[model samples]
Target: MKNTILRFNDAVYRLCIAVAGLSMLTMALIIPWGIFARYVLGSGSSWPEPVAILLMVVFTFFGAAASYRAGAHMAVNMATDRMPPALRQGAAILVQILMAVVCLFMAVKGWKLCANTWNQFLGEMPGLRVGVSYLPIPVGGVLTLLFVLEKLFLGDQSHRRVVRFDLVEESEGAA
Candidate 1:
């Protein structure tokens, strides 16, 4: 059962990475086209700038969730690292609890924001709803929350084989 949950988280982590990467890639493609269209083609495209901005939001939120799971998120641990083992453990629990609270706030408030904005459409991209652009916030919050729960209950899965394929390769090479 623990293995199943870890596998599920691994899949989620991959998905988050994929979404963030695609968003970044698409944004990279878009901004250049917008610049080219304005300077070379003598006409600016209306959709590209707004679309790129939306993509940036998507990239940031999804990438953050994946970063959290991978233990790559920015954390100032110098103070905690200096503590005794028992104090360090307590501090770690406190940090996780704080993380969980922040995640819940993001999920709840983000959903409310989405719902409130659902009726509005972007002027630059008429077909796209404003709410749709904000979807990543709640989604990312939920994903990060899941990772937090996994850590609290199952312990850190960052060392698991599925999460760290590079470690597996290194072990195989040594063997």
Candidate 2:
């Protein structure tokens, strides 16, 4: 059971990385095109700026979830690291609990925000709904929540073979 859950989470982590990476790559490509179009072509494209902004939102949210799972997210451990072992453990658990609450808030409130604006459409991208653009909030919230639970129960899979590709390659080379 534990192995199965870990495997599933490994897949989820990969998916988040892919989504975030793709969004960033697309934004990178499109922004340059937008600049070129405006300066060289003497006309600006309407879709690029709005699309880039939306992609940025996607990149931020999804990338954050992946970073959290990989233990790459920013964390202020100055105070916690100074504590005794037992106190440190308690603080870690408390931090996870607080993270869960924040995730829940993001998921619930983000979903409501999406629903409330579902009918509205973007002026820049008329066919796309405003709510659709905000989808990363709730989706990222749920993904982060999953990682939080995995850490709480499975005890930090950051060192796992799936999460640590560099370590895996080193081990394989040694073998």
Candidate 3:
């Protein structure tokens, strides 16, 4: 059961990472084209700016969730690190609970925002619904919530190293 859950978590993490990476890549490509078209071509394309903004939204939210799972998100651990083991554990639990509450709030409010704006269309991209862009809010929230639950029930999987290297083996192979 534990292995199954961990596997699922790993899959989700990888998926989020992939989505974030693709969003960034698309934004990078689109922005330069937008600039070139505006200056060099003497006319700016309407699609690039809005598309880049949408991609950025996707990148930020999904990237954040992935970062949280990998324990790479910004945190001030100065106080917690100084505490004794028992106190540290207690503090960790408290923080996780608080985080869970925040995620819940995000999920609820995000969904409402998404639903309410479903009828609205983007000015630049009329085919795209404004509400579609807001989807990452609730999706990211749910992902964070799942990660918190995994930590609270199963244990911290963040410390598990995804990569390792052997210098000796590499040197021997070179020789």
Q: What RMSD, rounded to one decimal, does every model reach?
A: 4.0, 3.9, 5.7
Candidate 2: tens digits of C-alpha lDDT, residues 4-115: 7887898899999999999999999999999999999999999999999999999999999999999999999999999999999999999999999999999999999999
Clashing pairs in 2: none
Whichever of 2 and 3 has more lDDT, that candidate is 2
Query: What overall lDDT, based on C-alpha atoms, would model 1 receive against the true structure?
Result: 0.90
What are the per-residue Cα lDDT tens digits for candidate 1 across 58-121? 9999999999988889999899989999999999999999999999999999999999999999
- Please give the TM-score that candidate 3 achieves against the real structure: 0.90
TM, every model = 0.91, 0.92, 0.90
**What's the best-to-worst order under lDDT?**
2, 1, 3
| Winning model by TM-score | 2
Q: Itemize residue pairs with steric clashes in candidate 1.
A: none
For model 2, how big is the CA root-mean-square deviation?
3.9
**Candidate 1 Cα errors over 4 Å, as ranges:** 163-175
Off by over 4 Å in 2: 163-175
* Backbone clashes under 3 angstroms, per model: 0, 0, 0
